[model samples]
Target: MGKHIKTIARPALQSTIKGCGCGECQTSCQSACKTSITVSNQVCLKESKQHR
Candidate 1:
């Protein structure tokens, strides 16, 4: 019997942005990472700033 293995789907991030910005999921920037321990900045600063 084969061991159960679930593959996690990585978010589609832009080359310009690098990471997905969701600290819980994909790897993000230190300045923008939003975790329980620390909240230095926003989740998606690049996208928000770009749209605005």
Candidate 2:
């Protein structure tokens, strides 16, 4: 017997460059995210007041 595999849906690709600077993967993530984060070079970062 063959086993059934489950598939997971991942977030969509970045919609605009602006969203990228604001830390969003795509429109769907931006709309779903409750907290604000920044994304650069395809990395998600938190905006901090102090440079750390």
Candidate 3:
């Protein structure tokens, strides 16, 4: 008998964002990635530090 393996979806940044857009999602510096999964420290820090 063959065993079946269930497939799991990759955790995307959108899922980690908690809320969609709504301003709240953008608050976290870690969630700054356009795609959101890969957190861009340079951009997030630069944006928040320089812009804010």
Candidate 4:
């Protein structure tokens, strides 16, 4: 007969969600660019998670 195996618990994972710093920009165009960049990055991360 085979010996029984035990499972071990893993530590909780931590992550930081950072923005593209659109709010810190002086011009409206710059702010809009930041916002778009941030949103695109976020969406990419989400998709990557699903694939993994």
Candidate 5:
């Protein structure tokens, strides 16, 4: 027997990148970038503010 693997759909990948969410949400142009690639949550272009 084989283990089942969960997966996200391709049509979902067809969606766009919204924001980096690093607290630099000043402008639409600043917060967004056109991407033909997928971004990993493990990496951030900017540091986020404290959650307090």
Candidate 6:
């Protein structure tokens, strides 16, 4: 019989900042910005499957 594997999504160690033009919060900081900035540190997940 063949075993069935389950897939799962999980955050990886490597991540990047989103909406930050300079990659670093210099003049326009999302947290301190008056206007709504969808700036956030995004973590990418790998497509992996697990065996149960």
Instruction: Please name the candidate that would achieve the greatest lDDT relative to the true structure.
Output: 1
- Tens-digit lDDT track for model 3 on 1-52? 2268555655555653653334422443444455454434324443355577
Which one is best on TM-score? 1
Query: Per-residue CA lDDT of candidate 6, range 1-52, in tens?
Result: 2268555756643553443234333233466446534443432122121221
What TM-score, over all chains together, does every model reach? Answer: 0.24, 0.20, 0.19, 0.19, 0.16, 0.17
List, residue by residue over 1-52, the lDDT tens digit for candidate 5: 2268555543543333564445553332323454323334333335334332
lDDT of 6 at 51: 28
Q: In order, what is each prediction's RMSD in angstroms?
A: 9.4, 13.7, 11.4, 12.6, 9.3, 12.0
List the pairs of residues colliding in candidate 6. none
Q: Candidate 6: global Cα-lDDT?
A: 0.38
Once superposed on the true structure, which residue ranges of model 1 sit more than 4 Å away at CA? 1-11, 14-42
Alpha-carbon deviation at 32 in model 3, angstroms: 13
**CA deviation > 4 Å runs, candidate 3:** 1-5, 10-19, 30-52
Let me know the TM-score candidate 4 reaches against the reference structure.
0.19
lDDT scores in order: 0.49, 0.42, 0.45, 0.42, 0.40, 0.38
Candidate 6 versus the native: TM-score? Answer: 0.17
Task: Spell out the clash pairs found in candidate 4.
Answer: none
> How many clashing pairs in candidate 5?
0
lDDT of 1 at 28: 38
Error of 1 at 41 (Å): 12
